[model samples]
Target: MGFSTEFNSICKFKSARELEDLFEYGKTKMRKSGFRIYPTGMKVIAFDPENRAVAIVQIKASIAEIDFQDREITLVEMDLVRPLTPEESAVETALAYEMFFRDHESN
Candidate 1:
């Protein structure tokens, strides 16, 4: 997708209730984990069909930084990648929204 298309795709949340649903799930996890939640921002990077990655979502609110499965290069990491598929993007967005809301409910 182009830049504009990507922007529009991210803006596809049609209703507050959708976000609310995600928030509720996050709240549940937060209560169980004894952690606080914050909206840390998320991006779904689709480098490939099987390499789609979810960028940082829950950051310093619960942890300092995103460790990305221990693939941190420290000195040099890759830049922005491709766009995620519909399914992959949906999952990442839901996870981020759920995590944020869960943290809120826990606190």
Candidate 2:
């Protein structure tokens, strides 16, 4: 009749892969259609696990990596390997940036 704590409750996550798996699923559990990763300088290079080209993700943030504590945010320069889309616009499925902005939000 009720859910269990171990399924969704917070606990000691043993490894990065485990956490990444959780994050991948976290996308669906989200109620908001949009998310903002502020301090845009903190954005890092990452890819979808399924190799799906999730483009124009309307104010959504893409996470390439994470650390639970002893965190550090730094900029790394790199050239763009390829474009998200050839037309410099979003696809129908990828219409992006509709969410309200917030300053204190954290990933």
Which structure among the candidates has the greatest lDDT? Answer: 1
Which lDDT tens digits does candidate 1 get at residues 1-107?
A: 11111221122222344334333443111111112223334332322212223322221122222245533111111222334467876686566456443453332
- Badly placed stretches (over 4 Å) of model 2 are 1-73, 86-88, 92-94, 99-107
TM-score per candidate, chains pooled = 0.24, 0.19
Candidate 2 lDDT, tens digit per residue, 1-107?
22122121112222345335434543211111122122222322222322223222221332322235433322112222232453432331132222211221242
Residue 96 local lDDT, model 2: 21
lDDT of 1: 0.30
In model 1, how many backbone clashes occur? Answer: 4
Error of 2 at 71 (Å): 17
